[model samples]
Target chain A: MNRRLIQWIAVALGAAIVLHVAIVWAIPRVIMSVAMKRIGGEGSVNAFMHTPRTTHEFRAVVRPSPDLAYSICVLDLSDGPVVIEVPASDPYTSLALYSAITDNYFVRNNRQDGGLAEGETIRIVVAAPGAMPADVPEGYEAVTAPTEKGLALVRRVIENDEAMPRLDALRKFSVCARAS
Target chain B: MNRYLYWASALVAGAALAAVSIAWAMTALQGEYRSGPWYTSAVFGSVDADMYTRARVAMFGLLALDRRETMYYTAATDSEGNALSGDCTYRIEGGDLAAHWWSITAYDAASFLIENEQRVYSFSQTTTEREPDGSFVIRVSADPQEKNWLPVKRGESFDMTARFYNPEASIYADPSAAVLPVIVKEGCK
Candidate 1:
């Protein structure tokens, strides 16, 4: 009877550990999936969608940056490489990519020195490994995304209340599109 | 029959425990690794992070760069260690922080930006009006004040997060030495 009791206790303890781990692992993925779908709609496609500007009240996402004029694109690399471009942004501008499952693929912000080109206009290509076009011009940057579907967001800091109109003009003209 | 009943009950209890513990861990992880009112972790947004830390950050929001490139600090309480309420007026005062750029932003209990008229959600290094010594104090409350005012509502509790992008190397070497703002509660309704 003692042996049987020990076995039952051990089995229960083991089961708890496994279930605990699975739930922890799955929470982020579930939240990210719901977020991506809500923002980009269903399926994989790349379009430069703009976040609302000239507002301080936070929306659904926790910890949204109040300083940035955000532009997002749903990156679906299965269609081909996506090309992203920004107007001459201050040192605060950054481009970040998150996989559909919440893995960070790449981030290139104005802060980096040599890895990125310095100037008013910034351009980069997002493609799977070994998929970069050979004919692309020199000085163009490349970011290898590990997954076929991802989120690419651009942050343009609104330095002050007066800077909004200029930022809006810049973001409205920014491009996130499939490379020909 | 006794042995079978015991085994079944154990399995059911184990599953229940798993669900409860997992939920608690995720919700409470934000409160760890604190310095004063700021809750932060040195390992955030790094590819080299362990599995559990990565999961916690991802549950909030994932970052492509590591903390060296950008660090995040969140505050939910005041200097006196009281929870920040929308009804209270407070002052966020500090000297020059050791970072290239920084901003303090506000969010309500649900993590959404608080609704206000001035349309001010954050005060950054550049926009905040400063004193003669270059130090600054920002007024935070439902009513508007003179300079560097960050408005909140009257009935909601708020969480403020401060972002330090490209922080000085000294911060990574010894986080204790960093200069942080103090949230002093003035009064409340």
Candidate 2:
């Protein structure tokens, strides 16, 4: 047999491997992009899109929790900083911020007086680091997202079936709007 | 010129082969060893994670909390080192359910919940029928059982994930010593 066939086989294997790595690396980016489009494509920069109900059979997203009620927001900082507000509730409240590449860089929970606001509302400004406009309004604290494109997620733990109403009320506090 | 082109092609191919293999190994070996019966990693979704850990977690989903928040442990094989098969039946018997909230969820090889007539995907602490000693046994099979049965469809392989919310510190410190459930193979059709 000629040596060309063996060489070609090795070359093909190498090419396949390269393609595999590229796909693996790009999977997270592509998934996040798709998620952003699905959750916020029609809404403006500050609109909050709440997931109706989470189930084990949620095929659009992978490995979602049946224990938590989630609300999603797409942050587009190129337009301006978005003000994220949530009402304090019992049990617990937490917000996780994911970058374009899906890195959860910032997570603030109700503990440490972090998300704890009692009956009042908790307000935070999500903006790109050092890109926050100086004229932004007062009383809205700023937390920087590592990327211009990011996802803001608020998760509320459901104790059981009876807790759905209370959980629904708590999840309603999650809203976003462009800050002038 | 033709010989030079051949050598260049081989170089690019070799690089691709190495890169792809490393990616597969990362998914295979990265977070699969964080526990005894579970493969939960503290590094998932953390901002402080290294480059590789971040890549692996994002490959699956964008949402995960720190270990103090939630711990997701997945098992693809039984304790005896057999790839979980939907063609077989397995009995998962455990002692007291050990976490603030604990659940055992069944996912197909593609990572989706297995479908059945009941449309059930998991059994948790608050729902499972317990024995007199408070121990619980969950039967996993393609066929239906009378009680404490979790359906696993046939024709495709599957895996199970044991999720613990705020688990005991010891379970995280030394999971091998933790009282994980026993997965005993029962019968196959």
Candidate 3:
């Protein structure tokens, strides 16, 4: 090949590498944004959208485990911090936080919290990086999120068909709201 | 005009190549660990995940937890290196897992639950029946089995995800060392 052809090949290869990196870097952000919008739906930010049991018909997210009942909170810390409260359930339950770029920054389960007694709740204050509210209430754990906007997911294990009613009721009491 | 045409063609060709390369990489790359037919990535949902792992997880498992919270193992092929098909019956055999709780769920090629009449999708540690020796067996096929049946579409491909919630420390140190279930292809329709 001539010098001109070599130059063209170089340009093409360079463009390919740049495009490849750019797309790979953007995938998580774009997908997470779309998920937040879909999960948020008509509800405002900083509140939990208590969804029913995941089934084949549930298309809001892919690869959803049918065994877990999910309640989502689309966290938007652009304004301020948000608070989340989860009611401890009989079976396994967890609250996991994911950044806007899909990194699971924090996770806490019922067992990890020393297996709280009945009628007890797990309260967490999620704020932007270095923006935790000073007035966070007692008994509430405060955490710093890596991004201004992300997702807070609570997963409750559904042992069997018979246990759905009780678990569903327990998940309804889970709350997500602006930190006062 | 000729220079503009050449540049345009080169850029378009480059873009096309990138698209095909990314598509192939997303499907072909199976993380860093492979145990039998099961494979998992430790960096999934962690800040340390690379660009490719992050992109793949975003597409396949949007909100997956970190390895410390949950270790997710997936198998698209059987132990004999055959692609898992809905037409084929597989005997998923395993014993107790080293986790607080574990579950194996079936999904279609598109990573969604395979729609079926019974709406059955997964079997967990608390749900499966055990043998006299304490081991368990699960059947994956289009037809119903006598016990522990996980249904799939008749003429489509599928995959299984084994989730180990709060897995043991040994599992996190080395996932391949964990004794995951085996997917043996029994027969096909």
CA lDDT scores, all candidates in order = 0.76, 0.72, 0.88
Write model 3 residue lDDT over A1-180, tens digit each, in one string.
798788888888888889999999999999999999988976678988778888898887889998898888989898889989999775678899999999898888888746865446889999998899888889889999999999999988888888888887777788898876
Over B1-189, each residue of candidate 3 has an lDDT whose tens digit, in order, gives 499888888888889888988998898885689889998988888888888989999998889988878899999999988999999899999998899889999998878988989888999988999989999999999999988999999899999999998899999999989899889888889
> After superposing candidate 2, which stretches have Cα over 4 Å from the reference?
A1-27, A88-92, A111-122, A132-141, B1-8, B32-34, B95-99, B168-179
* Cα displacement (Å) at residue B26, model 3: 2.6
Error of 2 at B57 (Å): 0.9
lDDT-based ranking: 3, 1, 2
Any idea what lDDT model 2 has?
Answer: 0.72
- The residue-by-residue lDDT of candidate 1 on B157-178, one tens digit each, is 9989888777899876666556
User: Judged by lDDT, which candidate is best?
Assistant: 3
Q: State the weakest 10-residue window (summed lDDT) of model 2 chain A.
A: A111-120
Q: What is the RMSD of candidate 1?
A: 3.0
Q: Candidate 1 on A1-180: residue-level lDDT in tens?
A: 698778878888888898899877776677666677777776446888887773544344556788877788888888689888876556477877887656666776776775333346677888876787776656568888877877887877777778777777766767788889
What ranges in model 1 sit over 4 Å off? A1-7, A42-44, A54-60, A114-119, A133-136, B1-9, B27-33, B63-65
Clashing pairs in 2: none
Q: Is candidate 1 or candidate 3 better by TM-score?
A: 3
Q: After superposition, how far is residue B125 of candidate 3 from its true place, in Å?
A: 1.1
Per-residue error for B2 in candidate 1, Å, reads: 9.9
Please provide, for model 2 over A1-180, each residue's C-alpha lDDT reduced to its tens digit, 9 standing for 90 to 100.
Answer: 679868877776766766666766776688788877866767655677777556555665566665567887888888778888876555555677888887887776665454465446667888888877776568777788899998888876565567778767666767787876
Model 1 chain A: lowest-lDDT 10 consecutive positions:
A54-63
